[model samples]
Target chain A: MTTQQLHEQILQKKSFLCVGLDPDLNKIPQHLLETEDPIFEFNKTIIDATHDLTVGYKPNTAFFEAYGIKGWVSLQKTISYINEKFPEIFTIADAKRGDIGNTSSMYAKAFFEDLNFDSVTVAPYMGKDSVEPFLAFENKHTIMLALTSNEGAFDFQTLETNGKELYKQVLETSKTWKNSHNLMYVVGATKAEYFTEIRKIVPDSFLLVPGIGAQGGSLSEVCKYGMNDKVGLLVNSARAIIYASNGTDFAEKAREEALKVQQEMKEIINSKF
Target chain B: MTTQQLHEQILQKKSFLCVGLDPDLNKIPQHLLETEDPIFEFNKTIIDATHDLTVGYKPNTAFFEAYGIKGWVSLQKTISYINEKFPEIFTIADAKRGDIGNTSSMYAKAFFEDLNFDSVTVAPYMGKDSVEPFLAFENKHTIMLALTSNEGAFDFQTLETNGKELYKQVLETSKTWKNSHNLMYVVGATKAEYFTEIRKIVPDSFLLVPGIGAQGGSLSEVCKYGMNDKVGLLVNSARAIIYASNGTDFAEKAREEALKVQQEMKEIINSKF
Candidate 1:
């Protein structure tokens, strides 16, 4: 989906909340383990429960991948389910994939074409050539990692380079790449203050914020500093919502968690826009 | 496999040549396209032909991922074929994956446990927590991207940071992480001179060098500056070796190309050790 379509969905739903589908077999309800495809079943229920409350579903590819070929199958089913059931919902393949130019093209094809995710997260360490391939796809978004929510974000991202943080350099340099209009960014919600600086570089670009809920990032703080006129912030909440209750009411409980975030997001949008 | 075993295999084979299994459907012989699993069939023939000449096999994951579920099945079969047939050969999943601590563990588990690769390449844009989980795996290696082979490497990796290059800081900081002995690095062979400086921070670590044949990096230049007592390098050549022929003689032609690189590697090992 295009950013404009995503913005329209945000306005229509009165929510910019992106539910993270990071289903872990060990963490899912014990009863679901008997099912043929537990991961997909879990995700299906979550999507069924929370689809209307959220504008997007960001599936962390790592969780599915950890299960092997079976995992890939479950992942395929999950994405297909989302697309077929909720075409308007933005799909983010939180794969964090990037490589050399030709290789990166293969990745772009895998996530954007094969799996049909609206956007895929990518690491910016490989630079322009690695990313431009993803950008080449019109309407498909390439969410490049600017400043991650993890502790490791400080390792290289925060390093001072040419009188500015490396991530700022990444944001500025990325704006110059070919087909950069399709670019979005992965800016962590853990550092809400950084959004002020991040917005300066890519003022209109969407920011997929991950770190709220279980990661201890404040929704209010992120909205205060990060939200734009289009509400260009996809604040993701994974564990806190998905694994809310490991019982039969897991999906219901997940909706409860999602509804809380959606309610907050609705308030933010109503007050701002 | 342990680095010691990898070094021993390099000695026994008389070549540290890592045959990069980046099988592209468009490039593989037309005859194989008619097969049940063309990617696996292509990889099997290549492995059968060159297993004796090369000490390691590095499968670039993007090539497999591009095909979706079928691609992952091919990858599983290819890796399984190698482990069962040639148990001693070191396997590198050139996935270039890294994420948050927990997520990185999932990736490490996927590659090291599920995929059963001896090592996996990772992007070091994220800091210590992102990589340490990969290092936590016993006897498995995590090859973090230091300086890549592509032109984009110059964008962020070579940028000045903390009075040293970002790549240098990556190498130095990586050494301090827990179980760092399992750590290796992806140092592209495009700029051979960078090896001399990389060695200062990580003299003993095995460096998986790409950009050898197709990307115009010199093996001799890399060996001169990068090699140590363990002959610490797995020089990869994918397209130049694998795509040597597009006819029925493809496997034979690939073997011939691998032999040429193997012979060059043999000469380097003989001169040094």
Candidate 2:
């Protein structure tokens, strides 16, 4: 989906919320395990329950991959379900994948072509050749990691490279790449102050913000600095929403959690616009 | 397999050659397409042909993931085949995956426990928390990217951070992680001189050197600079050997190419050790 279409969806729903579908067998409801494909079933219900309150679904590939082939099957089913039922909703494959040029093309093909995710997250360690392949695909977004939410983000990302931080260098270097308009960024919500600095590099580009709720990031703080004129922020909440309740009413409880975030986002949009 | 066991195998074979299993449907012989699992069939033949000459097999996950569920299944079968048949050979899941602490744990479980790879490649862009989980695994090796073979490696890796280059800081910081014994580094063959500096920080840690033939890296130069007392190198060649001949004699021709590399490695091992 184009950024314009994503912006339109944000306007219609009044929520830039992208519910992260990071389902784990141990954390999910016990009763769902009896089903043939518990992961898909859990995701199906959660997507159904919260689709109206969110603009997108970001499924971290590690959760599915941990279960082996069965997990991959569930991931495939979940993605297919989202695309078919809610065609307008943006989908993000939060698989932080990057390799050399040719190999990265294969990854771009897998996520964008085969799985049909609107975007896939990429690591910037390998630089331009690693990312340019994903950008080559028109309209299909490549959300590169700028500043992550985890404690590790400080290790190398914040370290100064040539006068500026490495991530700032990353954002600046990325804009010069071929077909960079398709670029988006993954900036952790915990660093609200960094958004002010981040905006200076890529003013119009969208930022997929994780680290709210469970990770101790404030939605309002992220909005205060991160939000652009188009509301270019996908504030993701995974564990705080998805694992709110593991009982039979898990989906309903998830909706409740999502609704809370959506209400906050709606208020923010109402005030801003 | 432990590093001790891997080093022994390298000594026994007189070749630290890691045959990279990157099967593409378009590149593999047309006749294999008739098989039920063409990717698996191709990998099986390659493993069967080159197992003796090589000490390890590094399957680049992108090639398998590109095919979707079938691709994953092929990957599973290929790894199982290598473990069951050539139990002596070390295995590297060339999946450069890293995420936040919990997510990285899931990926470590997927590649180390579920997939049973001896080692798995990880990108260090996210830093400590993202990598320490993989290092937490008992005997499994975590090969972090230092200086990659591609041109993009120059983008951020060579940039000065603190008093040293970013990649050097990666090597130095990685050594402080828990279970640093399991730590390895991916230093691309294209930059042989960088290996000299890399060796200063990680003298004994095994360096999984790619870019040998296809990427224009020299084995002798890498050995002169990178190789430690225990022969700490697993030089990888993917396309050069595997895609040697796409005809019916593909496996045999692949063996021939591997044999040439093995011969060169044998001479190096004999002279050095």
Candidate 3:
């Protein structure tokens, strides 16, 4: 998806909420488990209910990969379903993948061409060659992990290097990479304060902020610092919204939870711009 | 596989060579394309031919994933084939995977518990929660990307932080993580000099050294600096060995290439002690 298209979708939906479709077998509604593919069934229902309220859907590959081939089939089905039905909804393959030059190219082909995701999250430890292949795909965004929401983020991302933080260096060096216009960044909502520095580096670029609801990051704090003129913040809330209820009306409950966040996002955008 | 078991296998094979099985559709023999599953067929032949010579087999996941669901099925069959046929050899899933707490757990289950890989490569960008989950698996190895061979490794890995290199910080901090015993590292063979310092922090840990043959790093240089008292190194050679020939004698040619590396490794071990 192009930057203009993504921005238009955000405005049209009146929300920047990117619903995270990380469905766990044990966490989904018990009724869906009896179906041929419970994960897809859950994601399909969630997408159907909340597609209009959100601008994007991110299905973290780890959730699908845990079940082996059967899980991968469900993952393919979910992405296919979304692309066919909700074409406007930006899809992200939250597979934090990176490797050598040729190997990274294979990964680029996997998520972008084969599975057909608009974006894939990548780890930046390996640097340019690993990330360049992902950026090589046109209209496909490479969401490099800058400051992750996890505690592990502190291990290397925040370490001071040459008078700047590691994540800052990542944002700086990434700007020089090929096709960097398609680049996006993953800055955890937990580190809302860091957005001040992050926005200074890549003001126009989109930011995929995870760790809002379940991970205890405040949506208001994230929007205050991370939001750009185009409202360039895809604030993701997964477990808190999707697993809002374990009852039969799980999808409906998910919509209610998403709408609440969407309403908050709408207010944030209105107040900011 | 346990540390002792892997060490014994290394000693028994008289080589620390880890043959990389990364089969590409266009690169494999043309006749294999006529088979039911070309990728698996290629992998099966390679494994059958070179299983005895190498102590480990590292399957880069991107090569399989680029082909989609069928590719994933091929990966499942390949791993199952390795485990069933050559239980003695250590298997490394060269899937550079890492994520948040629960998500990382899912990846751990996917590779270790589900796919049954003896070890899986993880990117250290995410930090503690991302890596600790993989370490949670008993007798399973978590080979982390410390100093990669590619030019990108220069990006964030070698950056100076706290009066130490970033990769050095990773080594120092990783020692304090839970289940540090399960930890191995990926220090690229291209930078053999870094091994001197890396060995200081992680003297006993097995380093899965790549960038040996095709990537243009000598095995002698890597072993000189990388080897531990346990003869700790699983030096990988992928394209140089697997794509040795594309004819009917492809497997035989692969063995010839692997045998050459095996003999070199045998000499390294003999001369080192």
Judged by lDDT, which candidate is best? 2
- Give the per-residue Cα lDDT of candidate 2 at A262: 99
lDDT of 1 by residue, B210-266 (tens): 999999999999999999899999999999989999999988999999999888889
Query: TM-scores, in order shown?
Result: 0.99, 0.99, 0.99
- Expressed as tens digits, the lDDT of each residue in A169-245 for candidate 1 is 99999999999999999999889999999888888999999999999999999988898888899999999999999
Better of 1 and 2 by lDDT: 2
The reply for model 1, stretches above 4 Å from the true place, is none
Q: Name model 2 segments beyond 4 Å from true.
A: none
CAPRI-style quality class for the chain A–B interface of candidate 3: high
Q: Is the docking of candidate 2 incorrect, acceptable, medium or high quality?
A: high
How close to the true structure is residue B136 of candidate 3, measured as C-alpha lDDT?
A: 94
Task: State the RMSD for candidate 1.
Answer: 0.7
Of 1 and 3, the candidate ahead on DockQ is: 3
lDDT tens digits by residue: candidate 2, A1-273: 899999999999999999999999999999999999999999999999999999999999999999999999999999999999999999999999999999999999999999999999999999999999999999899999999999999999999989999999999999999999999999999899999999989999999999998999999999999999999999999999999999998999999999999999999999989
Task: Please tell me what DockQ candidate 1 reaches.
Answer: 0.90
TM-score of chain A of 1: 0.99
Question: Global lDDT of each model?
Answer: 0.93, 0.95, 0.93
For residues B57-129, could you state the per-residue lDDT of candidate 2 as single tens digits?
A: 9999999999999999999999999999998999999999999999999999999999999999999999999
